[model samples]
Target: MAVIPVAIAGAPYEVRIKAGILAQAGRHCRPFVRKNRVAVVTDEHVAAKWRATVEASLAGEGIASQWLVLPAGEATKSWAHLAQTVDFLLGQEVERKDNVIALGGGVIGDLTGFAASMVKRGCGFIQMPTTLLAQVDSSVGGKTAINTPMGKNLVGAFHQPSLVLADPLALDTLPLRDTRAGYAEVVKYGLIDDAEFFEWCEANGEKLLAGDAQAREYAIARSVAAKARIVAQDEKETTGVRALLNLGHTFGHALEAETGFSDRLLHGEGVALGMVLAARFSARQGLMHGQDAERVVRHIGAVGLPASLRALGLDCDGRRLADHMLHDKKMDAGTLPFLLMRGIGQTFLAKDVDLGEVAAFLDEELAA
Candidate 1:
């Protein structure tokens, strides 16, 4: 097991990455689970597939649990589901001291984490992220959120989990498409700042996607460690240091909004393409080498991820897409910052971005 500690203000937690760790969840979580009983919030898909294993794991250590299984999908992160989950936890007699276990992917983690943050003022929760997306990115960061009518993640909180158990085995059940999408985030950490790691990913990305256990574990550990270091420096993103993690998120969130946050374009797929756009835009702006930008796009495409807006066939123009970015949660005082690359593994926050120029760039990209 590889354990990475995230030291954030007010709360600190550990993200444990290992294969077949779900069975050990009970023993691993006993210390933080104040009550012998835990309320597990999961999605229907995950419950149908892995709930038995998770329940049995908890039961092994005399930890009884009540389950609040919800419908799976991006839509589950809504006000209605939030209320339903909180009500279910209340009915389960979940106290502030009791830990609420999030037993699914990003949807479950965000919804459950937001619910835990609000219920009884605040409560503890453990993350048992099943999907590759959750294991690497969403589970480590305290940025739990639900999409709103306005945009993705417009409503949420920063409630750190007590512990995070990312079992690569759970990913065995993940579809190849989802695995590839999740690989985008793993590659993201490398793109944000670690040139050597980026090179490693370039070489091993195919193997990782092909289910090489050694490669998967190594990638997860590296990604988690990178995020842990950034979160420790800027937990709430007050300082600009942590914003580097959003290397592709600004453009990616806009793509997500354009796709209605649906499966039409998975979040990581959007990020994959978004990172390419960021790289290309940086090159266009003379900040990065053109070949370097092409390399980023090529690698993302090589892994079967979308690397261009033209491929998505969205029925919108640059101005329309740029409008969506105005709703991004990262917007501050009506000013949006773009994470632009100076080169591979060299990204910087560019607050001087002109939305008009961005629209023009998107127009060119869409025309491509």
Candidate 2:
């Protein structure tokens, strides 16, 4: 087991990553858990596979743990679902010192983190990330939220966890589509920083996807390291350095909102397609070489991730897509601050961009 330190001012925690760490969750979580009760927030899908082991581990620590399992999907990240989780935790007689454990993917993490932020005004919480996407990206960042009608992750807070336990062994049971989908975020770490890592991914991505344990650990640690550095510089994303983390997320969120934030276009899939679009748009603006964009597309495409919006087969036009961008949280004064790249490992936010030009580009891309 490896514990990587995430040192954010006023929000320092560690992200522990290893295979088969699930069986020792309580031992791994001993430091943060002080109160007697622990709420293990999970989904029905993950509970069936690992709940017994997790429960036993907590029982061994003499800490009583109750499981709160919601249905599996992005829809679970909503007010209705969150209210239910809070009710369940309150019924479990939770206290401020007692902790809520996020024991599944990003949805569970976000909802549970939000609940922890509210229950008794605040409570201790731990993250047990099971998916590749959760391990490397969402679970590490302090960004946690539930979805609202206004937009995805609109109702969230930067509620930092006491500790994050990521068991890579859990990824073995994830469906292949979800596995490949996660690769998109892993690729983002490379795109935003560490051009060497991006090139390494292009070369060894197949090995990483082939279920190599070492490869998985390296990806998680390196991605966390990069994010930790960025967060150290700017925790709340107030500084533009952290905004670079949204490399493909602006267009990606638009795609997600257009799909009603459903599983039709998974977050990572939209991000994959969004990264492709950002790269191509960078080339169109003379910020990057066209071949560099193609290289990004080809690498993501080879992994079976969605590298183009066209592949989603949605019945939408460019004007509508550009309209979706208007709702993105990053928009300010009607200008969408897009993360454009000069090349791999060289992304900067572009404000003062013309949405009319964006609409025209989308129209042309949609027609093609």
Error of 1 at 134 (Å): 0.7
Provide C-alpha RMSD values for all models, in order: 0.9, 1.2
Q: What lDDT is reached at residue 159 by model 1?
A: 92
- The sequence of per-residue lDDT tens digits that candidate 1 reaches over residues 254-357 is 99989988999998998899999999999999999999999998999999999889989989999999999999877999999899989888889999999999
lDDT of each: 0.91, 0.86
Clashes of 2: 0
Q: In angstroms, give how far residue 295 of model 2 lies from its true place.
A: 0.5
lDDT for 45 (candidate 1): 90
Clashes of each: 0, 0
Best by TM-score: 1
